[model samples]
Target: MDLRDERELEVTRRKLHVLEARYEASRREPDENAHVHELSLRSLKRMINQLKEEIARFELQTLRK
Candidate 1:
């Protein structure tokens, strides 16, 4: 993978970490934490998208080199 692709992946990984922290912070035993959970879910989706884009870019880069 190219450097840019790896950088983007790293950013997404950091975001995932932040999301996980937020998710844990919002966790309340015997109570619903919809908002934080939702944020975490959305972050997961964003992470997935980032990963897909990185994969696509890596594939194209491979084709070039």
Candidate 2:
């Protein structure tokens, strides 16, 4: 991994944090559309997971260098 890859990983990590916060906020807020909230939370969780995977891959790639 080069400088560009490192920057990308940092961006992805930041995005994961933002999504996690949004997911928590959604859980705490009372909404009339509970189903929609659940769907949105699920989507956010999925994105967080993907970003985590990307970060891990980038780190491992860097380590191999």
TM-score winner: 2
Q: Pick the candidate with the highest lDDT.
A: 2
Per-residue lDDT of 14-44 in model 2, one digit per residue for the tens? 8889998998998899989999988888898
Alpha-carbon shift of residue 37 in model 1 (angstroms): 1.0
lDDT of each: 0.62, 0.81
Per-candidate TM equals 0.50, 0.86
In the range 1-65, model 1's lDDT, one tens digit per residue, is 34366666567567656755655564543347777777666676666566556656776886798
Error of 1 at 49 (Å): 0.8
